[model samples]
Target chain A: MRAKTADKIATSIIIAVAALIVLVLAGLLGYILYRGLGHISFHFLTSAPETIRKGGGIGPQLFNSVFLLVLTMLITVPIGLGAGIYMSEYAPANRITNFIRLIVEVLSSVPSIIVGLFGLLVLVNLFGFGFSLFSGALALTVFNLPLMVRITEQGLKGVPREQKEASLALGLSKWKTITSVMLPISLPVVLTGTILAAGRVFGEAAALLFTAGMSSPRLDFTDWNPFSPFSPLNPFRPAETLAVHIWKINSEGLAPDAAEIAAGASAVLVITVLLFNFGARWLGRYMYRKFTAIK
Target chain B: MNSIIEINDLDLFYGDFHALKHVNMEIPEKAITAFIGPSGCGKSTLLRTFNRMNDMIAGTRIEGSVEIAGTDIYSDEVDVETLRKRVGMVFQQPNPFPKSIYDNIAYGPRLHGITDRKKLDEIVETSLRSAALWNEVKDHLKRSAFSISGGQQQRLCIARALAVEPDILLMDEATSALDPISTLKIEELAQELKDRYTIVMVTHNMHQAARVSQQTVFFLNGEVVEYSETERLFSNPTDQRTEDYISGRFG
Candidate 1:
């Protein structure tokens, strides 16, 4: 075959593959919205589910998902950033460092269901935390921490070597050079990765099933005190996130409109994750501009 | 003129590779010294040793002593940070922080705890003027360092190095990446800077060494083959290798 003809064939195949991916994504999104959008309303979004009734809502589950995400991030960000900085900047390349990297890679690839089982065994039973939001957040941390560390490490490594050299040659302390020069340049990548991880936390179900539990206590939204048992802010209370609620409703929900509730909840979950992905891109670009002064 | 930097039997190794062998020289204060040699011949490596920048490289070892202002810089008592503060370096590529023009100049000062706004402003102005960049960038002090042209960015880097008021300034092929006009501008700036700061430069261009430097050192295979006044070395080279190199016989 002629080289030009072969090149044309290769280009078409590549475009067809890319188009197939976009088509699949669009079809999935269209089907979910078509089945779920009609059922969505302010009442459906803000009211509690009816266990045996024809009408049900996912208000508390939605709030639980958001709250659990915030809690997990509060625990994960500091630990992840610290570990990442050490791995990228401070840690010498040795057997120990390589072992730590191997552990992180292994941890990230662990099945979410396995993580849930482990959470049930350790956090719920051994630690005596019970099936609470705190336990779920901890479980999610195990799932998300590896990702955050890898992202931060890669981001820091992406910074130009000359930037670090320039800062050091100016007599800046090692710590100052990292915090002032390196971190700022890598912030966009780190921020985007953090939000992408947050999206994972939002849509995660299996990990939360055995840790956060499949039921929420009657929540008092007006009770802003974190220590109160009934307050939504309480991390110790049993909570069901949107993804878990969708799973439970689809499996054995007693409600007559269980399928509709599941569909609607799934749609909401998808929308939230999509929003997070877009937000990460936009925020990353915005930060890069703010930090670097590039238009 | 009094010598400010003295090297006594200095040798450097990058793992198994001997980079600099038995180097000895006394560099005068407030003058320009240029190291001209072929690539990988240790001109840049010797420049890095002045501020211990080579310490960042893995498996890099050194012997003998390098003294600045009569103190052995390799001694345990000499803080690397303080040593670096006294000796500033500009690299081949212009590497201004991804920040405003003003911030790039003020970065060194801020690191050493200079936070007063007015004082930082004065340092910014004077440093820029010293680098001959003040008039061009005065109206755009808040602009990003990358917003300017490449030549301006190189000048901005020079300004950044000058902001800390170092006694010794090292330029490692500082204009190699620049256009001819920018290169000429930097050469002029180096000539002016040597009146106050001890200047050392490594250059691939031999004419650059002859044009700007007072003392010229020629290296071959990690050893200095010639060290003398630039005029004498170029016009009346004593060594056969130096004569061949200067007359464009070979690297």
Candidate 2:
């Protein structure tokens, strides 16, 4: 065969593979929106679910997902950034550091279902945290922390060596160089990773199932006190996230309109994840510009 | 001329590999001194030793001591940060931070706890003026440092190094990555800066050494072949290696 003809065939095959991925994604999104958009309303978004009734909503579940995400991030970001900086900047190339990196890689690849089982055993039973939002947040941290560390390390590593040298050569302390010079330069990558992790937290079901529980107590939205048992702000209360709610309604929900509720909740979850992905790209670009002082 | 830097039996090693062997020299204050050599001959390594930049590398060791301003820099009592502040350095590549022109110049000052806005602005202006970059970039101080040409960025880097007000300036082939025009500009800037700051530069171009340096040191295979006045080294080299290397017979 002619080289030109073979090159043309290879290019076409690559393009076709890329097109297939886009097509599959578009079809999945279109089907979910088609089935769920008609059922969505202000009442449906804000009201509680009704068992044995045709009308049901996922309002509390949505709020729980958002709240759990915030909680998990509050726990994860500091630890992740610290560990990452240690790995990239401070840690000597040695056996222990290599072992730690290997562990992080192995942990990230572990299945989410396995993480849920581990959470159930340790957080719910052994630690006596019960099935609460805090337990769920902890489980999600286990699932997300490896990714956050890897991303943060990679981001910091991506910064040119010259930048670090320049700052240090200017008599900046090691801490100051890492924080002011290195962190700002690597912020875009770190921010993107954080948002990607948030998207995972939002759509995670198996991990939350055994940790956060499949039921929420009757929540008082107006009760802003975190110490109150009935307050939505309480981390100790049992909660069901949007993804878990969808899974439950599909499996054994007693409501008459369980399928419709599942579909609507699934659509909302998909949209929120999609929004997160787009937000990651936009925020990364915006921050990069801000840091670089480029218009 | 008063000697500001004195190196005594300085031998440097990267692990088992000897990088600088038995180097000894006294560099004069407020004058330009140039180290000229081929790649991997330890000119750059010796330059890095002045600010202790070599400490960043693993398994690098040095014997004897490097004294600057009557103080042994390698002693345990000496602080690397303070030593670096006193001895500023420019690299082979132009390394302006990914920040606004104003911020890039202000970065060094801000690190040493200079916070008053007016004082920072004055420091920025004078530093840029010293680097001969103020006239070109004054109007667009808010623009990114990367927005300018290669030559302009190199000047900005020089300005950044100058902001801390160091007593000695080290340029590790600062203009090697630039065009001839930019190289000429930097050569002129080095000439102007040496009267205020003790400037030590490493250069591949022998003409650059003769043009700007009062004293020139030639290195070969990790050893100083010759150290003398620039005019004498070029016009009447005593060593066969230095004479051959300068006349382009061999490195």
Q: Give the interface RMSD values of the models in order.
A: 1.1, 0.9
lDDT of 1 by residue, B1-251 (tens): 89999999999999999999999998999999999988988999999999999999999999999999999999999999988989999999999999999999998998899999999999999999999999999999989999998889999999999999999999999999999999999999999999999999999999999999999999999999999999999999999999999899998
Off by over 4 Å in 1: none
Looking at model 1, the pairs that clash are none
Q: Residue-wise lDDT of candidate 1 within A128-221, one digit each (tens)?
A: 9999999999999998999999999998999899999999998888899999899889998899779978998998999999999999999988
Rate residue A286 of model 2 by lDDT. Answer: 86
- How does residue A47 of candidate 1 score in lDDT? 91
Question: Poorest 10 consecutive residues of model 2 chain A by lDDT?
Answer: A271-280
- Residue pairs in collision within model 2: none
lDDT values, one for every candidate: 0.94, 0.93
